[model samples]
Target: MLVSTRLGAARQIADEAALALRPEHPEYFSAIPPPDPKALRSDVGGDLSQLFLLLALVCLFIGAVGIANTTLVSVMERTAEIELGRALGARGLHITVQFLAESTLLGLLGGLVGTSLGMVGVVVVCAVQKWTPVLATRAEFVAASSPCRNW
Candidate 1:
């Protein structure tokens, strides 16, 4: 609801600006009619942001399942090693902490390597396409400030 309201407000402001400029610049406004409010509303209703959000959620679930499976296998394979550690006075908490630390490090390293490879791939594709690789500074800044710790 709030998003719709804000979009409506923005549309109104743009319409007013167009009207103000119409007399001075007749060529630009001659063929452009004001956008229908209902049409605009309907168009903005199905935002791609929500789609990307859903995709992100699905990816997160898949990643979690994969990690869980990997951890389970690791635990199973290292049962004897863990038992030895326990026999040597390693507490259950200590084992849990060690596993958590290893997983965290794996995630971090994977992210870094993946990001580097992706960037190189993008650059190569752009070069092959004969397009200048332009980076949006504002977008980069927003991404840097986001809670998501992108590599």
Candidate 2:
């Protein structure tokens, strides 16, 4: 369980030591084993990260499509209101801006709720583990300004 920045040099040194000791004690020499110098770091973490990244991307795509579909349906359902606004001098650009603003508002609200919940979860886990909560500057600020303690 030696941690080395240079595995090649470390393994070679261990092997040389083992070989040196082998002639005097052939019976115990078999116990000395050297790890493969060419063996790479395990890919399990990288594989898991890539898997989660792909999953998040897929979920994001689906969420975006859902948002778009819901907004489209809302606009369609409110066609009469839109037409009324137009008759009352609301320009086409105004209508477009309205929907854009609505979508942006929805996104912001989602961000706020999601972040809050995530922060609370982090705080809870930290508390349960008797560990300090580590957060980015923005989150630190949020926690500092809020009623939450022990973060």
Candidate 3:
């Protein structure tokens, strides 16, 4: 059963509904006041945030594993070159630093490529939808600042 009331009369209508139904049909009288929808919205938002955080952690783990595997493979394939460098008086520290720099560069490049692809995908989707891409900077700032209580 659905009942529509004028604006700002939800509570009154809800109470009326409860009063009317609770007497004869006690089993069917479930009164949900106006605040319930807001509460449910917050609850769903919290659940979605937790889900996104979990997904982000999983993706970070996968990316770390991929970087480590790539670094290991590069080192393995360059074993001969590394031995040659050592024979020519390259210290262990030098080799370690070289590998570290290579891995750092690889990670940075991966991030840049991923960012570019994501931007392109967003643009493509917007174009396909014939929607103008609007940047709501104020809303973004408010949302970003809300968690810090600085908004």
lDDT per model vs. reference = 0.63, 0.69, 0.73
Q: How many backbone collisions does model 2 have? A: 0
Better of 1 and 3 by lDDT: 3
Given candidate 2, what's the lDDT at residue 98? 95
Clashing pairs in 2: none
TM-score of each: 0.56, 0.61, 0.70
Q: Higher TM-score: candidate 1 or 2?
A: 2
Per-residue error (Å), model 2, residue 48: 5.5
Superior by lDDT: candidate 1 or candidate 2:
2
- By TM-score rank, best first, the candidates go 3, 2, 1
* lDDT tens per residue, model 3, 110-142: 866775565556556667777654433463322
Task: For candidate 1, report its TM-score.
Answer: 0.56
Please, what are the lDDT tens digits per residue for candidate 1 over residues 41-108? 77775565566678767866887777777778888899999999999999999999988887777666
Stretches > 4 Å off in candidate 3: 1-8, 21-28, 33-46, 134-151
Best by lDDT: 3
Q: What lDDT would candidate 1 get against the real structure?
A: 0.63
Runs in model 2 deviating more than 4 A are: 1-56, 140-151
Candidate 3 — what's its lDDT? 0.73
* lDDT, candidate 2, 55-84, per-residue tens: 767866887787788789989999999999
Q: Largest TM-score belongs to which candidate?
A: 3
